[model samples]
Target: MAADVRLSSLKEWDDDQVLSAMSEGNRLALAELYERYWYVLYRVAFQKTKSSEMAEELVQDLFVQLWQKRASLTVRRVDSYLFGALKYSVIDSIKSRIVHEKFQEYQQFFAPQVDSSTEDQLAYSDLLGTIETELLKLPPKTQEVFRMSRFEGQTIPEISQKLALTDKAVEYHLSKALKLLRTQLRDYSFVWLLISFGQL
Candidate 1:
């Protein structure tokens, strides 16, 4: 039970103590670090990305990197260091995504002449089908608002009038739908293509 007492006391330990424990390969110490920083890191990430899944993935990857590099990790203030690391990671992810989007735009410009194979057509159809399926998973009102705004070429004011919603309510639903789809379609290479094509 001595070990239990030690682990229990870890919650009250200072940064240096936690780092020492981590350096010594204590898994409990790593768990403590994760619990201590996950929420704040997630908040920082979410604030920047406005996507819950991206925020979650960033924090999870941060902890995984910390654990993997524990022996070489050096920090005078754990919270400051974690937040700084998170800031850089978020910036890098955003830059990479922007580059990916630009590349997709380039591809779309040339796609009609260069990529008209049956296989390419089938893949594009599959992506649109998947996007529609995910859109259906949204709340009924959100789904309708999103479809009206995106699919029907309706302006926000038009959508509000059509749905009998206040302008604010229509904006809220569109924001929610975009955030949800950003998470759901993150892994699809053609997601940017769809966005550029005005089909997202």
Candidate 2:
């Protein structure tokens, strides 16, 4: 009888072989690829973000996206593909962090000023009312998921398990809710001002 080849042997295989295996829905191949590349990618991400948690999340998210889109993915050079993706992911994460920090700073700068004006107070109150109304307008499941994530401070996995929905479905609903809310509230200048200042 012939000895069976171990999956661990694939670690010695070249990128093309691994990519082909991954394209064929081989979970072992995916695992191998992850094991091989995760540390390098994590290092790159950490160097870029300078936040261990953010770097870890970014790398994990990349793998998740890769798995989710594996069916249609075509890679000639796995190293180039993965490193390129990581680079772009780092760039996007940096951009998002910058925007968030700017918004937070803006909020802190204007928070003191907003409290001094009766008109500003009324506008802020109205904005909150509008946001509540918009939240009510979301689909029941979407609204529940959003509320759990935002109000109850539940993580996506927690919300998914609690609602018996897949993580992707939960994320979809949350994205949809945000899109709708943005659309509904886009026309309000006061809301934009408040948001820019981190008031809302």
Candidate 3:
């Protein structure tokens, strides 16, 4: 009877407990983790994307990625992992937007009507260039993953298959790569958002 009670008690926990379970490949644990970090990630996404739908998408994507890689996952600290993930995810998203905007600009240049306003466009272009340079500074494999996910918009599974890696390995690489980007682009939310989107 005492053992039963203890087991029941062990089933219930806050963020840290859920994370511990998640590390052990428990779906319920991952769900609990999603509940704990969703709002925080959403806020970060919102700050960067400035679009509720996009922010929601970003959070949703992050959780989905987490779930997909639950097996063979381990974390020393849940808070750091969650926040670091959010930071990287946000940066990836922002960088993707920058890339998309540049593509749009390219298309517009070839189109009939180009925007008359050049100053803001130039500023944004320069900012994007800076962001790209930072991305290039990442390790080659990390850069490849980031580009495949952010630029090519490949799914995690696709990336894993293409790279001949396990799903967990892919997740770890992404998480680690994002951590590096988070540290490098800590001050720039826009840059962070771009990368975060790519991260997922």
lDDT of each: 0.76, 0.73, 0.69
- At residue 86, what lDDT does model 2 achieve? 87
Candidates, ranked, lDDT? 1, 2, 3
User: Each model's TM-score, in the order given?
Assistant: 0.56, 0.61, 0.52
Can you give the lDDT of residue 52 in candidate 1?
98
Give me the candidate number with maximum TM-score: 2
Count clashing residue pairs in model 2.
Answer: 1
The regions of model 2 sitting more than 4 angstroms off are 1-6, 112-119, 126-200
True-vs-predicted CA distance for residue 135, candidate 1, Å: 38
TM match of model 1 to true structure: 0.56
Question: lDDT tens digits, residues 1-200, model 2?
Answer: 12125385687898788778777877788888899899999999999899999899978888876876688897878989999988877875675455456555645654437347887767656766887899898889998987665544455655665788988998788788777777788877554543323111
lDDT of 1 by residue, 65-168 (tens): 78877898878888888998888778756754664565556557534455488887777677677779988989999999877665544555446557778879
Better of 1 and 2 by TM-score: 2
Give lDDT tens digits, candidate 3, residues 81-179. 767877766775676566666545544553333564677567656656765787787777877877776556555665776898876877776787787
